[model samples]
Target chain A: MKTKIFGAATLWLLACGPAAAESITWWVPNWDEEAARELVASYEEANPGYDVEIVITTWDTMAQRILTAMSGNNPPDLITELQSRIVLYASRDMLTDVTDWFDRDLAREDFIDSALATGTFDGRLYAVPFRHDGSGLIYNRDMFEDAGLDPEQPPRTWEEFVSFGEALTVEQNNVITQYGTAWPFGNLDNAVVRYLQLLYDGGGTFFNADRTGVELDSPAAIDAMQRLTDTILTNGIAPRSSLEIDNTGLRELFANERIAMFKGGPFDVDPLVDAGMNIGTATLPGTGGIGTTTVDGFSVLVPGRANNPEAAWQFAAFIAQPDSQTRLTATFPANRIAAENERFSAPLLQPFLAQLDEGVPKPSAEGWGEMQRILFDHMQSILLGSATVEDAMMSANEEINALF
Target chain B: MKRSTPRRGFLARLRTDKDGEWAPFVLPALFVSVLLTVYPVGSLVWTSLTNIGPDGVQFVGFANYVELFQMPRFARILGNTIVWTLLTTLGALILGCVAAVALEHRAVVLPGVWRAILLLPWIVPQVASATTWKWFYSSEFGMLNHMLMTVGIIDAPVAWLSSALVVLPAVALVQIWSTFPFVMLMVSAGLQSVDESVLEAARLSGAGPWQEFRDIVVPSLRGVLFIVSLVIVVWALNSFTIIWVITQGGPAGRSSIFSIYVYESFRNFDLHRSAAASVVLLVASLIFAIAYMARLRRQS
Candidate 1:
């Protein structure tokens, strides 16, 4: 019996060793612990021969960590990365060119054109998008009903939005009791991106057709920023104080019913639901009959130097499978067919799915950090009364032009 | 003063110290210091001259330095660093001196209790303190607004952290509270050494309390004060955790200091620029360090 036990233990140790097994290091930005663990278990069950070591990372550290790892000889086989980081890694010739690996459906019909286009630069594909997220307006159903507006009908136009927002603003004794909306403004620079989305939705493009010029000097872009700022600061609907609160604090207030509506994404969904809000979700109201919002999420990229590039690609492609994606992530898959199915869609996400056309990709550029800085600086100037809408947009254009 | 070196030849000394195990005793620590401190600093200076980032780096000489001066964001960050350092140090200094002077007075009651209470802020972990301040600064249902409004001093709740003005002061307050204890401890030590005979003599000779402080106390405590100032300068210059946790230099990038800016560059995958920014911060700190050393030399 002792001999049998010793032999079994030795066999287990041999199987566990890296030399014996084709172990792939998969890096992911940290998320729900239990859910991630469950998904990993399912994957391990499915792929019996292959072992997946899921390396969890934080958002703040992800970019630097991945880059440092890649610079080293023994980098991870596969990495789930941010779109921002993907562009950086791809620019450096660190990622494996995935042109041959991409399936026909992934190229032609399964994936949306713009979403697929974001992962590729110039001519070669460098990454595959894992999950997608962007912004939308989450309103209080009770607050809308109390304000005498139909909760069922959400705002579709900029005019209707302003009017509804005005009706919801509650003030007494020169103090706001309930704010109409908390469009987070100032300091944090998240507000700047939201302003860009507003600008985009207003038929304003930050760049020209060739992705070379700075056209943010246009009147439409100027008007979009001005309207957003005025609505928050000058106008009584959205509070200027919302500018002070960071994203987390603002979300908390929105959850706690202090704010009637919030500009947020799916990450805020479950939290709001847990907080007991009668949530009425809708796409961002637009000026030119089309809505736009900023998209933020991870991409999968294989490093250039891999012990097993084929195995890495296989594992990556496996996770990105439509069925696998639907099972794992809270996000709608890049696969268009997966999106059309109610089987893949969760209950709270029905509204986001309905307004799928509103999901426009944010502009891709080599020096995105610099571009974001210019965009953020102008947006703040608009809030601080240092610059008018036109001036701010023009400033952004000039700065970005100098950069890109 | 105690060394006995009577007519010993160099050969005799060499023989006396020959094959000494002191090499084994001190070499490990010396080697560690060389590895940890010397090597990294040398590399840091080298990195500052290079375009080190996610992509491969190449030697850029002083281009990073030239760009540092040219970048408006760098200027903003520099100005922020100066203001934040000055404000935090000045605030910490003033409050600490006052508390120390107050504690020096024997007429003050419950000195032990007061000392314990004062140390409370410093005793808490920095992360915990920062997180608490973040909650305190929250606009909706924040402890600050709640307490202020409940006192009936203000009819409406003010957003304590959203406005640029309020956030700076609130962050400063947290730092002030956390840091004053160190200064107080130092000052109190310095104060005890202030000769009681000298104070009594001054009082007997018609020196007022102000005169005693300005003349006797000031001159006597100058050494401690100088040391304290140096420490505060370094702390204030690098102090980012409290502000980072509380505001993260936001509400329109109003509070982006040098340290925070370095972090931003790193976050944005521009660590080459971050390294360059770090050199600028290092130079600023080096100036203070040199000044502190000069003061120490002057005292000696």
Candidate 2:
């Protein structure tokens, strides 16, 4: 009788013990970790059956870590990868198709078209866009005031942009104490993005209509390339040391008053303000025609190695919701409804939203990685005066075409 | 008794004689070597012959090698690698020997402090050194350019890292600074083995300082110099951190070496091409090793 009672008691104890909660690992870029953690905490609170682990990664190391993890058969359940890498990841089948999640669980029509298009590859959703950024001009109002240019009326045409820059530049005995603008000709990622914007602004595209071939050597594109490089070499408005700075480096120079202006987005404003600077925003100047800029962003994706796809998808869907995006610290939300929230309509972020209205997503073609690499080399050649615009364009087009 | 002979043969196979005793001692080392070096190298060889792409892995054989050879940048990359390795190795050795001899001289004071200060570059972390050097090499605001400008050396800032003709030497200067301490330490040790009396006799025989150094010191340090140079050549050839952190093999790849090409390939998910590049690099390193070992054998 006592043994029977004891067995019943043991069974009762076993039943009372806590069940193992399903856990999913998330790798996010360093910038969005705090927002991600808050969202994850809310997710765990709302869904008691799961736990989450967030690993912070940077852009420089994200690709490498993801590659290693995928190949090692130990990939995180979800990762936040940049938009440029989505096509590569999707083409390689490294990411899980989240089409059904988007279709069944969310209102797909509410997403910003460019943002959704960036995450879609070959008619399947491999990732969900979170925060999006596009290139625009951020100018120093104080420098504009000093140069006797109207601070309220930023340059809208390429000619005025160059003239304004030349006016704002400060030189002391041939050493530039304050550069008119810091164009990032050094780093490939920034340089290529700027180049793409210029190419698009000049009414040129990287590929033929069917996307079967590259057309980087087109006259319009070459003219665009020549004009951009000429701003540095021919006009002498840009610092020769411009090659020493990346996008962030340009922002730093602007913050420190070493540069008067540069290409950036709404996200750059707050940081520069926090760093104690007076900055203004404007649409990127156009080449006397319709303006265009390339959209760039980060996306949340579930790897094929996800241990808990259901739970991972749940997190992805939750994070893409308007509520979660509204809490993000920087970069405009990818959700149109969330981005339209009253707070984002502030004067500081409004220009970025306007710019995003006309922004085009990066090319989703398979050969984009190789194309970018070759373009970077050729762009540097032109910027450094080693190769002519015609020569660089021809060479880059030939190499990029060979890849296709 | 007849069956005992078979057992005795097995025991003799495991004998600890002069030749066979090393087997037991080296077994663990061999196991580690196979695990770390031999196994990875074998995997690299296998991977080089396979294309692990979007379609998954398949044997493609020499296709990757053919493509790599036909790559337009291959010749330039090879030339850059050779120039970088040779210049960095030679520059470090010359600078190190001079510093070592000067520090070892009797006229020098605070030798210990000087030695510690000289070794600071070697002791500091590579990432730190690279970051510091990046700041130092900055064109408009860098201390190097700033100092030169302050002294009225030039009216304009020199584009140390941007100009193609100047970038190779600029990067080599950083490599030399970071690496000379290794050569210094090695040469300092070699100097300890030099006979002071031999130097004294040379000096007493009406030999000036230059003659004493040429006649007595140079011959004594030849073997040390040779070994240091060979090691440094291999190290500089394989160097990635300094160049990667500083220039990222850019300003149009004027400073790119073989390792950067391999790394870029790997980063781009071109595993077959990366593996093929790795194999070629391994072969080049092996040739250096073979040449070094053959020279050492001849000297012995």
Candidate 3:
């Protein structure tokens, strides 16, 4: 009788302890963790029996960490990967297909077509985009006025762009005191994206219609490569030091008044405004009367090995809603409804919003990153005068073709 | 004890039964080593032979190795690895030996403080050092260029990290700076084992400082130098932090090394190729490791 009473007391004590809760781990870039944490809190409040643990990760090591986790079969239930990497992950079978969620839970028409296109692979949706980012020209108004150019009107054609750059460049005794623009001539993301924009503006495609062969040796590509190299070598508008600069470095140089103009996305507006700089926005210059730019962004994905994929999808869907999207200041929302909020239509983001109509997503082929590296190296060679534009483009074309 | 007379042979005593007394202590360690070291290495080798990609893992034995060998970049990358390892290792050793010998000399003052100061490079984190070096090498606003310009050394600022011709050497200089301190500390510790009486005898024999160093000091520190060199060779061969932070093997792959090659492949999601590259690096490192072990055995 005493043993039975003791057993009953142990069972009661065990029952009195906190209940076991299903937990889902979410990994996101460090930039948006504050808003993500708030979303996670709201997700937990709405779902009583589930808990969401958000882990902040940095861009430098995110790919390595994700690969390691996926190989070990211990990846987070939910992760926000750059749009460039989502297709790579899906191709590797590391992400789950969530086509049903788009069809049932959310109205597919509510998202911008270009933003939604980033998450699809082979007619199946493997991720949902939360932000939309694309490059544009951000010029210093004071420098524009100093150059005797109209501060309100920006260059629309390639000829005007070159002239404006030449006019804005300040030199003393043959040594450039102030660069007209920041052109990243090295193996930087800015250079790669800008090259893509140039290619698009010239009405060129990276891959052929069937997506089997690269068309880098085409006339449009040659033109883009030659123009980019001339911007540094012949035009002397951008500094030679740009060969060592990245996208972030470009922005920093522009902010420090080392450069008068540069290219960046909507996210750069806030910092420049906060730093008390008079900045003006303009669409990226076009080649043949068609202004175009490359769009790149981040998407949320549920890992294939997620213990509770349903819960992870629920959290992803929740974050994609207009309410949560409105809070993101770092990037413009991909959701059309959220992007229509009064905050995004301000003068600072007006040019970027107008650019959405002309923004083209980067090619989502496998081995695209490697192809980018090849293109970057060849472009650098051309800019450094080690290789001619035609030769570099031909070599890049061959290397990219060999990737498949 | 009762069954001792029934033992079959001396060789039979080597085999331990499952319930043997040493099993509890030895089994855990053996299990852990197999789990951590042996299993992973085996897996790496296995993965190198397979195409573990989007379509899932498939057996493609030696295809990855063949492809790696055929790639034009592989030859350049291998040559770069050799050049980088030899230069960085030797550069560090020479600088380290010089500093160590200088500090050990009787005429030197504030020996303790000097030794500590010399060790600052190795103690400081690699990322911080790389970042500082990047700023110092910046073409527009670097301290080095600014100082050179101030001293009228050059009419124009040199693009230290941008130009392909100068990038590899520039990165190697940073590697040399960061790692020589480690060599210095090791050599300094090794110097404590050198006998002062032998040096005095050399001095009494009318030997000058250079001759004494060449004859007495080098012979005495040969063993220490050898081990330090071996450690540094392995370290330099596997060095990634300095190069990756500085160049990312850029300026048209002028500074590309074996480690960076492998890392770039992995970053591109080419796992099989990366594994093959790592295996090649392992083989290179293994040659040095075997030499080190053989020398160690001979000394013992």
Candidate 4:
């Protein structure tokens, strides 16, 4: 009896060992690194032997470095990526298909199945999300009040947005001193993300369900891209200078009070608050019949040569649980129970939590990575007033079509 | 062994009889030349033929060449590259030569101070210089517009980098400004070697100042000019950092040149395109070098 008891205890400890013993490399992008660091510290304290080594890089270099590392012998044990990108890596055979891992350790029933679907491509789970992402209109309360617009009433519809954006647009000496609203088209991902949200809100398809071709040249999309382009060039609500700024650059400008209303993710608010802005946040504007937001988050994965896949799965499952997901949740908690908790109902956090139903992962196309550059050059041309909307979209469509 | 010694004597008997000692020096140089130049170039030529796109490479047998010639982007890049190299070289050469001639007289308040200041640009790191220029072009809060507005030169800050019409000139200005010091140093060294007696002889003849410079000083500096031009062309072709840091070959590929194009092709995981682009540049440089050498021979 004593021998059997001792053997059982050893098995239990070995099974529970990842929470205790393995050091994993966790690649973190430009999100809240400080919060991620704090999240890991508590984990280290709870689990004695295991610690995560955080490899930090900016957004531009992150994708390249991750791809470079995957080709080498040892890849990161855990990677944080947007929901849209989870499938791209899995398709490349760079990730572990965690279908059985999720079955034995976790389940879609335990987390928000829709959000988890982003990490699942073709019935195999590739990533487990750690945080949430949803974009909305973040405006300057002071600017709105000063401009004599209602601080409580942000734009609710597309038509309203155009007029609202125009009201805040201030000019001096025939040059716009302040921009009303702007979407930065500098980085390929952000442009795609924001555009995806716009298209979805406008009742459009990013691609056909099979992901065979682009739906960009469709009449609805032409209207959306054209109107968006018009908001800057023809409407004069946004400045042409916006094309020069990337996401971070745009956020910095917002923090510095150069832009009046910023349409960005929940991660943007804290920085503005830190910069001492009287900021107001809300759900991103909607159109047609549906209100849409892009649901994106990072996830942890087990690379090949994981010292123990079982242990990695246990930790991944444990983190997906409400206990861990709630604590680690910055924008979206994958756990439905954790997402509804009052603890996540803070000012900007409320929008991300509230917008969960509207959130959909941006489509993951096979050659979507190359398609981004094709999109960027054309988007830039449109923004810089180099080409008409039709011509620019046509060039973009042709280039994207060639990617196959 | 005795016959070997006599072979050198016989080789002297073969050609250039008095200069048999050159055989030893020339033979080692020939061996070194084959090892250094021939092997790497042979390898480069081999790789240039293969389609080595970002992921990995496969042998494609001139497919990279065919693709390169067909791409309109490559033609645009090639044209921009020619303009960039010519403008930078000619601008620097003219400015450098004039400064060297002027400074030779020691006319500045403190000639040593002025010379030290001139060398400052050359000593500055390329990245640091590029970064400074990038800030100066920044639209949000650049000092260029502050100065312009202060003087009432323009009502608003001109978008220097974002406009295609202005970007190439802006990039060329950076290159000419940063590299002129190098030309100055080279031309200064060459100018010091010009025979003062030749200047006196030209004046003694019917030649005026312009004729004197054209006939005497220029001919004397021919070797240095040829070398500087050759190096400048290669430098300009291969340079990626300044343009990469500043315009990023942007304002709609207006400032895009061969190096930036090659680097971007590699950046986007299109390695075959990069290799092909690099081979094109290598061949262009070789053609320039050969032309320069022939010119040197003819001038001599």
Candidate 5:
């Protein structure tokens, strides 16, 4: 009888013991740490027997660290990475396909087309974008008024942009006290993006249809290059410092009233507003109508070696939901519904939203980084007056083609 | 009458002998060095001879090196590296020697305070000082341009970091600024050991200041100068932060150096190319290191 009783107790313990909780690790950028922590807390509260860990990454180390982590034996279950970088990992087989989950759990029509396209490689979804943005014409309204231009009316065409720039420029004693505008030619990525925007707006594709070579030698490309360089060299409206400042530096110049206008994204809105600057936003001026901007953003992905892919997908899907996206994204959320929220509906963001419809996703080819670097070098040559626009474009085109 | 003593084994002797006593303590460090430094360097060398890609690493001995050398930009980058290294080393050495000599003069007041002030550039963090200097060199809003224009030195701002013709020297100037203080400190330490009696004897013999400095001071500081030059040369070769933060070796690779090329290659996921460049840099640095070791051996 004692042996039978002990056996019964052991059976009861075996049946009733707490199950092991599944743990998932998620890596997020430092900017999203707080929101991610809050989301993790709520997720843990909503679901028992599951815990999610958060690791913070920064801009300076994100690319190399992510590549290293994904290639290692143990990788985070989930990661928030730049959308442009998702295809690189996907091409390497370092990511897990989530097409089924995306199709079943999310409404396809509710997300921005370009944002969703960044995560799709060879007809498979590997990531879910949360933030999406493109550049718009961000100008100081007061500067426009002070320069005798209507504050409400921003430039609509490329010619108008140059003429307006010349009007807004303030020169005293041969010193540009208040320059018209600037480009982010100092940074490789920024410089490339700006050039790409022009290239696309002028009807040039960075890569050929089959993605094996470049079209930078096309007439449209040369025209775009000429126009961009002429802003400083020919128009003489922009300061020479355009070659020394990135997007952030350009925004600072705008804030200090040293410049009147520049191209920037929605993320620039809040800071400029908080700084008490009367800013206006408009779609980027094009050769014809609204110009096309390069749409880039952040997305959540699951590593191929994740131990808890199901839980990771679950959390990723949760984050993809409209409300969660709204809370997490500093810019416009990828979900159309979430973007309708009052916070993103401010007048400052409308132009960016409108511009998104005409946006093309940034290129994510395997060798795009190197190609971009090559293009950046030649673009600098054009800006520095060391090479003609045609020569620079042709050289960039040949070099980029040689990469394939 | 002879007494026989038992011969100690190696292990037994290691515990008692003064020289051998350090063996046990050093084993851990030596093992760590082999594990950390030796292993990584071996891996770098092996990686340099292959093409690493998404599929797998393929052994392509000398292929990566050949490709790197065949590229036109490689020649330009090599030239930039040599120029940058020589320019920075010589500039720092001359400035450091001058500051050291000037501070040692009896006519200089509060030499310690002046030394501290001069060391400020070295004491400030590299990233912080480089960033500040970048702003100071800015063409439009830079304080340097502002001051120069205000003083009627120039009518327009010079694109210090943007002009290809001027970028290398501009970045080299910042490199010299931050490193000269180190040279000064080393030279100052070397100057302290100069025999006061010898200097006085030269003075008594009616040697002018320039003559004494040219003949006595320079000769005595030869060893220190050599080591300092080697150190500065190695530093300039390995430099990344200053140039990266300032110009990013840009305006069409005008300031491109080997280190920047390596980093850019790595960031672009061309690991094989990056490793190859790194191996080239390692070999270049090793030459100086070997020279330094040889000098040390000869001196000993």
Candidate 6:
């Protein structure tokens, strides 16, 4: 009688154990930790017997950690990473091909084209983008009024951008107490992105038509380089401190009223508002009108070697939904329907959204990391007056092409 | 009263045999070293001979090394590494020796307190101090520039980290600051061992402070100086935290060294190139490490 009872219990456990509890690990950056935990809790509540584990990563260590993880046999079932990094992993065949799942569950037309493009490499989607944004003109409204310029009208052309910068600049005792604008020329990544914003705005492409090599020495690129360097070197409208700061430092300068304007993203709005500063936002000015901004964002990817691909996909698909995206995104959601939610309708964010209309995805070529470093070095040469814009761009073009 | 003899165990034999005893005791450490150090290093060397990428790993012989050498910036990066290592090592040695000697002077008051105060830079965490130094070196809002300008030393702010011309030295200064205290402590210990009779004889011979320091103090601390210099040279060659935190080898690779390049290559997923660079750095560091080991063995 005892043996029969024990056998009956063992049989029941064997039949129902896995069905009763299934767990999947999700690696997310610290910035998304709280939101991801809340989402995981909600997901667990809605679906019985499903568990999503959250592993917090950090900006400084995430790239190296992810590379190490993906190269190994074991990896988290899901990862929330930068969209720009998707191609690098997908090219390695380290990510699951989510194209079919995306098609079956999410509406293709509802997502932004550029955001989707970041996850698409070699004509297959490997990730589901949740958040997307591009840089816009984030300015101080009171500084604008103080400069005697119309606070309502931001620069719509590159020429006006320079002129307005000059007008807003404050000089006292020849020390230049305050500057008109500044650039994030210190950090290699931020410097490259800022330069790319100008390069794209002026109708220059980073790669040739076939995407085989760089076209940094093109007329459009040289023009962009000259205009960007001229802000500090020739025009003297910006402070020399531009070379010592990144985007975050630029925001602090703007907050302290040290500079009048800078190129920033929608995420800067809340912090600036919270600091009690009256700010204005506008699309980046181009040679003609609204310029192109480099679109980058976060996406959820399933590692190719994930233990639970099916369950990870279900959670990923659920997160891609409009409501989930709205809750997850710190910036604008990749889903157009979710972007239309009342939370994103604020005036400060509208310009960033408008900028997104002309946004181009950042280059995701295999050697882009090394290529960007080359470009950043040459750009620095121009800013430091060690090399001319033409010479520096020509060198950058050659060096980058040599990599290919 | 003949009793049955108890059998001796292997451990008992090992403990009894003095010469062979250490082998058993050292075997675990030897095994750990082989597992941790030799295996990883051998793997790195093998990886350096292959191309690792998204496609797959392909054995490419010396292609990675050839490619690294052929790169346009290789020479500049190598030159930067040598200069940075030398600058930081020499700067730390001189500054530390001087500080140690100063604290040892008879006129000095509360030498311990002064030594402790001077040693603060070394005691502070590299990340924290380097970050603070980065802000302090800022051209616009930095206290260094502000103080210089306020003192009428210069009419304008100096771009300590922005200009390629000044960036390497700027970062090297921070390296020197963080490491000199170690040199000071070593020299201070060495200073205590200098024979007092020789110094008294020199003073009785009417030797001035400069002569005494140059002849007696300098000669007495040669071994300490030699060992300290080798240790610091090794540290400088392997230096990453200060440079990485302060400049990230930037403003156009003006301050990039071997370690920075290795890290950058690794971050870019060019693992093969990173491995090759690591081997190069390992070979370079091995030269000093071998000398250090030889000196230690000779002393022992």
TM-score of structure candidate 3:
0.90
Ten-residue stretch with the least lDDT total in model 6 chain A: A1-10
Pairs clashing in candidate 5? Answer: none
Q: A119-198, model 6: which lDDT tens digit per residue?
A: 99999999999999999998898988999988799999888999999999988776787788999888888989988888
Predicted candidate 5, C-alpha RMSD: 7.0
What is the clash count of model 1? 7
lDDT agreement with native, every candidate: 0.74, 0.82, 0.82, 0.73, 0.89, 0.89
Give lDDT tens digits, candidate 1, residues A232-345.
767767776665566776787787777788777777888888777889888777774447776656667889876677667766665555555565556666656556567546
Q: Per-residue lDDT of A9-112 in model 5, one digit per residue for the tens?
A: 34433432336366899999999999889888876776667689899999999999999999888999999999999998998899999999777566667789
Candidate 1's C-alpha runs over 4 A off are A1-21, A32-40, A45-48, A104-108, A112-114, A187-189, A288-290, A336-346, B1-22, B52-56, B125-170, B200-208, B251-253, B291-300
TM-score of each: 0.87, 0.90, 0.90, 0.79, 0.94, 0.92
RMSD of each: 6.8, 7.9, 8.4, 6.7, 7.0, 7.0
Provide the DockQ value for model 4. Answer: 0.21
TM-score of chain B of each: 0.87, 0.88, 0.90, 0.82, 0.91, 0.91
TM-score attained by model 5: 0.94
lDDT of 3 by residue, B141-230 (tens): 678988998898988989898888888888988999998988888888878877889878888989998998788778888888898888
lDDT of 2 at A2: 31
Q: lDDT by residue for model 4 over A201-294, one digit each (tens)?
A: 8778867667777867887677678877788778877766665555766787677676788777777777788889998887777784335887
For candidate 2, lDDT tens digit of each residue in B1-300? 456544445456556455666577679999999999999999999999998755778899899999999998899889999999989999999999999999987899998799889999888998889877776877876788999889989778888878888888888888899899999999999989989999888888899988988888889999888888888888888899888877778888888899988988887777789999999989988877887898799889
